[model samples]
Target: MSNPKPLRKAVLPVAGLGTRFLPATKAMPKEMLPVVDRPLIQYAIDEAREAGIEEFCLITGRGKDSLIDYFDIAYELEDTLRERHKLDCLKALEPSFIEAGSLIAVRQQEPLGLGHAIWCARAFIGDDPFAILLPDDIVQAASGKGCLKQLADAYHETGGSVVAVTEVPREQTNRYGILDVGKDDGRLVEVKGLVEKPKPEDAPSNLSIIGRYVLTPEVMPYLSKLEKGAGGEVQLTDAMAKTIGEVPFHGLRYEGTRYDCGNKLGFLEAQVAFALERPDLADGVKTFLKKYIDKV
Candidate 1:
């Protein structure tokens, strides 16, 4: 309806304490943790840009100023590189650059939950449809179109809310927000309901919601209520679930490999997986992996 308002803004909720990373996250933001070479947040930002998001609001928290600084121009470093004719080095920094006024940051002020974190960006989102990309969940698209781009396209066609979903093991359904199937179309499933971290037997379906979401502004009001759900935290899933019948909501089976870099094992696996995707490092990384596996 009304042309879907043309999705342009994206919100990245990076306020988590990242207790899983502990000491490493004590000083550095977890979003700054490099997966292969680029920080995890970079991948999320790149994906948002690929989806035609022109502006971004980073839902940040205390000790997360580094996230903003990472996108700022390093004048001294750039000058030195320019003087030394290190064009390649300067070129490599392009992705980190954000045009003036294109990026903004808002403090979450509390460790409330994802819903509250997204609520903090209400002003930034205004009345426009927007996207939410979680940096901790780095999705590498198998089709070369970032996961958000895939969701964005679906949102344009359907003109409502869309979220990326993938089938997690039924036993692991408790680990994520599982979706209730309404209409099964193979590529997209109409969202009848959303259950945050449901027990295996209670889960409505194996398909679980991931980090990518294309949402209309309607969900913000639900988040504003700040009703604590599941873990006593204001869950974003709950907010989204509230809009199920009001807005056309669907779960998209996106083409991609999602890396949950929020945990230790997943983080390590992402490092190897991403490194293996790089042409410059693939051979060497493969050799090292083979040798290490042989020894193990």
Candidate 2:
């Protein structure tokens, strides 16, 4: 068989209504929420860029113009910053802007599901194996290489679809797509099967998939059927499950901390954790956190 094509592009599904964040998300996309100094979406894009992804396809929905605008050059803002000699401010915006023609935005137009959102990007993805990063799932790698980069390195070695997974408790198996094991090393598991949100008793293993995935383009046809599975929506997990044995699939246990910014508590925790990582803010945040904990 021909060698696997080099992974170049990535798809980010940012079309969710952000209902979990409620009023804060009323006028803004949840992915735009600030995590310390950067928006949640920016972190995902940075991770993809770190993985050598050159083009980005953002699957957007209504009222997501802010997300598109965020990656665009702010001519007026730059002018003001330059005029005031605010070099630092201008430098901060550099990474947020994508190349002139590398970014593509496709509209989802409905709240179908993750599978549907990904399927919308089929035209842009063409035939390349692509990476997918959920903005809400911010994964911080202790090794300095971003989570997607870690997965990309694994993909190059395995030459098939690779997904980032973590071992969740057995009782929590119902909350995620659990993997069935075929063979295992300490860091990677050969995926024999995948079940979407299976019951604790039915779960093949507690190795649950996170938001990071490097998928083969062959899965697009399965998603195109729009078949609603668990939770009565087009589940991406369902589509991935069909690819077993057809390709080499493996689950990567990345060394990272994942913050689920989709939920209230998780969002708060991420804010504090990310803040504590910043040198300028670390001391103050830690002091406040300790006092608050003692009072409670």
Candidate 3:
């Protein structure tokens, strides 16, 4: 039998200045921030792996070398683990999971916008469907599905654009891409149109866009024409909006809880919630939570 066409690549936009994080992000790429023990980007990569993405195009800038290094082989550390007979540690650091050749880091050069960052990986993406996973948004599913995978499954069947979405407070709809709903089952909602950060009262629907996206290559030209809006940057939401009626744009209500790690409060919440879920750290994290849960 002929092999099915592979979903060959994915673009991860990690070049953001992460200014929302202030002092801490001033020294680190927010993507490297840990949720429990794994870096935020690791979870993003893990999600891509779950969806069978073979190539990872990282749109990065200066001071982001640590992210690339973390996914590379640490010979000395592995050798030490081997010498000390720390089998579990050595296995945990296995190089196989890190696809060195499949990793391509291109310079974003400027923090123009999410669309610009995705454009930075144009060569890696080429002319095909590819997934975009934002590391700043850490998605967790008790149902064992990364939000992006849900979109991918939808894309696989429909061969069109799909985005992760959920209902946000109507007052805060301006902070997200608001979906104009057409038809709805329980899981997938047909998008009649899209709006980028519409004023609460102006919003057509309460559905807020999440970080997961499965887009076709045709969206690249639209992204290239993106004009700055909202934050003086070329918003991906604007680019996605351009595809409204032409593309089969739909919103997948992902069976997961998403955390915005770009903010301090959200990051802390993800760290605490993830720690409480880990078998090794749950007891300690729960105890610490009670100590500070009320007062802090």
Candidate 4:
């Protein structure tokens, strides 16, 4: 029998300085910020693992070592949990929750852009298909399939590039990399073209690329080209655009509610949504919000 293709690896770019959060991010890495109980980056890591991604490449910058340590062996913490007979909590602290050998961190060295950070992992990605997860964006779905996992499922069927996408307002198209959709299969839409922050008049469709992406190894060359675009930073959209006709690129309408945790409003919404979904806090949080809603 022919050898099966290797499972796709995931790359997460957590090297941003996160200047938006200001005082909070000054002392702690923004990706370390807790949405509820777990940190932001943890959600992304969990999502990737759930999708059967065996290896991960975290493109990190300075002041982000805490993220590495968070997933490392926390002996003292684990010991305390064990002594307290908190087996569940101790399990949460298990080292293999994020396998050490499976995860690698590479420094981006500069805040070039998303494309540059992804390129930094080229040596690690090693000419294979890979997934990119942006931790700043949190997604919640009733089903087990998170955004990245949803795309991975689609990739297996299509065997080409897949990006998680959703419809945004036509006027807001400039805020996203809008898609020029050619055909639709209800879930996966064939992408004929892509525009990065194009004016609404020029945008082909309102469908915008979300955070999750299952990309072909061919993207490495384009990302490596360091083609600077919007904000003088290397744009991933630009690279994906180059592969348009050559490779079959499709947009997946991920069935989930995506929260842009990088934004203040989105962060607040994520907190409420997560709180309401928690078995422990759901009732209390719902009661509190119902009472607070009237007063607000």
Please, what is the whole-model Cα lDDT of each candidate in the order they appear? 0.93, 0.93, 0.84, 0.88
For candidate 2, which ten residues in a row score worst on lDDT? 1-10
Output the lDDT of residue 283, model 3. Answer: 95
Task: Judge candidate 4 against the unseen true structure and give its global Cα lDDT, from 0 to 1.
Answer: 0.88
Superposed Cα deviation of residue 152, candidate 3 (Å): 1.2
Clashing pairs in 4: none
lDDT of 1 by residue, 1-296 (tens): 54777899999999889999999999999999998889999999999999999999999999999999999999999999999999999999999998999999999998988998999999999888999999999887898898999999999989999999999999999999999998888999999999999999999999999999999999999999999999999999999999988889999999989989999998999999999999999999999999999998
Model 1: ten consecutive residues of lowest lDDT:
1-10
Give the alpha carbon lDDT tens digit for every residue of 195-272 in model 3: 888999899999998888888877888877758877898888888878877767889988988989888889988998
TM-score of each: 0.98, 0.98, 0.93, 0.95
What is the lDDT for 121 in model 2?
Answer: 95
**Candidate 4, after superposition: displacement of residue 242 in Å?**
0.8
Ranking by TM-score: 1, 2, 4, 3
Off by over 4 Å in 2: none
Q: Give the per-residue lDDT digits (tens) of candidate 4, residues 202-260.
A: 98999999889999887889998998998899999999989987767899998989999
* lDDT per residue (tens digit) for residues 36-151 in model 2: 88999999999999999999999998899999999999999999999999999999999899998899999998888899999999999888999999998999779888899999
Candidate 1, residue 91: the lDDT equals: 96
